[model samples]
Target chain A: MKKDIAKLLQRKKKQIIDLWMKNQLADASLREDLMSNEELLEQSDELVNALLSKLTDDNLSNAESTDFDDVYEILSGISISRARQGFSPRETGVYIFSLKDALQEIVQQELRNDPVTLYEVSIKISKLIDSFGVVTFETFIKGREEVILRQTDEIAEISTPVIRVWDGIVALPIIGTLDSARTQVVMESLLQEIVDTGSGIAILDISGVPAVDSLVAQHLIKTVSATRLMGAECIISGIRPEIAQTVVHLGIDLSNIVTKSTLASALKHAFTLLQLEVRRKQKETSTLKSNI
Target chain B: MGHFLLVTIQVDLYDRLALNLEADLVQMVSKTGARGVLIDISAVSIVDSFMGRIIGNIANMTKIMDAETVVVGMQPAVAITLIELGLPLTGVHTALNVEKGMELLRKKILVDGEADNSDDEDQPGDGAE
Candidate 1:
């Protein structure tokens, strides 16, 4: 009976493909923009061929059996590719289940003469197709998750950038709220740059930071101390007046940390520590001197 | 290595071991008549509040004995932990390496020596003048 169903499917492959595409086209959730009709038909042809090649009487009861690996593989490939291509879950669901609808119609027509065997074989085939449809959605969701995970990794990579503002000085201007995870990244990158460049000073400009609570203050202190341990001095600059008040209201001890109200003053203080002098020369142009 | 004592802390110290080392370090400074002490702690990984206080105490004790102390080769993680523990390592001199610490200690001693010589020379000269 399995061989009979497989042979019937093998002989009417083109008809099955046409019926499956027709079923999909009839569904309102079909995503033609994500997948063209021609491409959808091509995918339909491949999945159907794989499914028929693996179909057998014993394996028809279960789609997860090793015997159905190739069919399952093709189904998952189509589902995941549809997900990445921005096809809706309903469209992907219809894509797999519609093929089952097409094949079932043919199976019922083929086994018309034998009632008992037809009931058993048709039920097994339905169960097998249902399992494969489920596998498709599972892989579909997984593919979407993969996209999210990659985007998250990319965000983490772009967030932290340690720039050298001057020789023997690197500036890390933190633009967001200071959290432990980001703090670890900031600490590692800062420490590595200090070691690599042998910089004597690091300026953590928090002007871009929106707020400074106790936890943030602690992370900042930890970073400062870590830079100091690497034989470099860290200056917490760009402390707005509100943050200063917050530090005082919380009674956090920042006396040991060299903090400046602005990055300019912090850079100036770093110059003093490095024994650097940046003196401006007299302007040569008469027009510039007159403006001054 | 000379009149200056070099103490490199290679082992990860538990509670009592660190406390004992602090006392021993001060004793050694006075016994050896060392002018300077450089403690290399680059190998010590974990430092808690207790160890932080011990370090502070070591620096304070050695200061009383008229010997300068420079902590050298502190790991970044240890420093961060110490700061988070609320011990900012105040009144403690730190250097990146032993050579830098020695140079700092020598410069400190030289500056002290210069002050002493000027004080001695100026007192009599100023009194006579």
Candidate 2:
């Protein structure tokens, strides 16, 4: 009976030590001290909670411990190293920020750092950040364009590679290469503006576009579909001869969207199709009656 | 002052107006001692995420300025576009149209003003209406 009681106490001490280690508290020495003291064991839960709360509070306050200057110094060092290896500052900045965040997190966990694991993490971080950096740069460039386009409501003229005239009644004018992103932007802006302006006809002039790929052609078709849904018409204008040949070679059908040679011709056709002459006559008659 | 500021964007297209059109409108409302703002965007044809975020940021900043902000004129397509873009215009208030937005602003203003005025009134013994 005495031997059994002693074994039971030993097991309880082991159990408490295991729990403490799992909770990321003070290591073997502290765990041993905790297990030996009956009074400390009694207050184990309270002590654990207090330690965790303190750590969290310290983390929150210490987050801003690294000043902007420190960050900038680290960034500059990374940039110089990257330049030596033939990478841009924009790319280097991304790689460094990502690595810094991961390194900080790992250090915070107070884990024993394996050199091999550190190397792997650094390589992964570098590649991921580089890719992200390239994408970020591209997005920034696109953002500048968006700003320009968004501000350019007063543009009197635009040119593109291909223009489509819909129903011989509207001229659809497109400019620049039509990527999926730009296509969506253009489509929504054009359709809403067309509706708001109450234009009887629209001219989609695309004389300024340098090229049209398969994705772009599909985007054009989708734009046409969206426009029809909104009770407006779309016309593709400025179909360069080479682009026409490519369209045929690629077997991409432009059947749904109307096509035109030039914006001027499309506008003329649109006017005739809408029978705008009648409206003009009606306006004249109303004015004459009012005068009388 | 009430929490909401009401401003009408009379232009048919917001892009055609000044780049700081929304900011200017908010400034006007601030001058009027409004604690909140409601912007009428029904007349706008296109609303990009950048513009949406600006409105949201304005709302957040307005809080610091002792005001709140709301955005109205969210067409179905526009709303969907904004969502698809993953831009959150959370803090701003949105209404169906300008009139509705104005009504909300007016109600808030009246309630706040009445509360303040009653607090200042010394005639506690006056008969209830």
Query: Highest DockQ: which candidate?
Result: 1
Per-residue alpha-carbon lDDT of candidate 2 for residues A89-160, written as tens digits (9 for 90 to 100)? 444343334333533344323323455544544454344335434543454455445556765533323422
| lDDT score at residue B67, model 1, on the 0-100 scale | 84
lDDT against the true structure, per candidate, is 0.81, 0.52
TM-score, chain B, predicted structure 1: 0.85
Q: Could you tell me which 10 consecutive residues in candidate 2 chain A have the lowest summed lDDT? A: A1-10
Give the Å error, residue A140, model 2. 14
DockQ of 1: 0.35
lDDT of 2: 0.52
Model 1, which residues run further than 4 Å from truth?
A1-14, A25-42, A56-68, A83-91, A107-135, A210-218, A240-256, A272-292, B1-32, B39-69, B74-93, B98-100, B103-129
> How large is the C-alpha RMSD of every model relative to the true structure?
7.0, 25.2
CA error at residue B6 for candidate 2, angstroms: 31
lDDT top scorer: 1
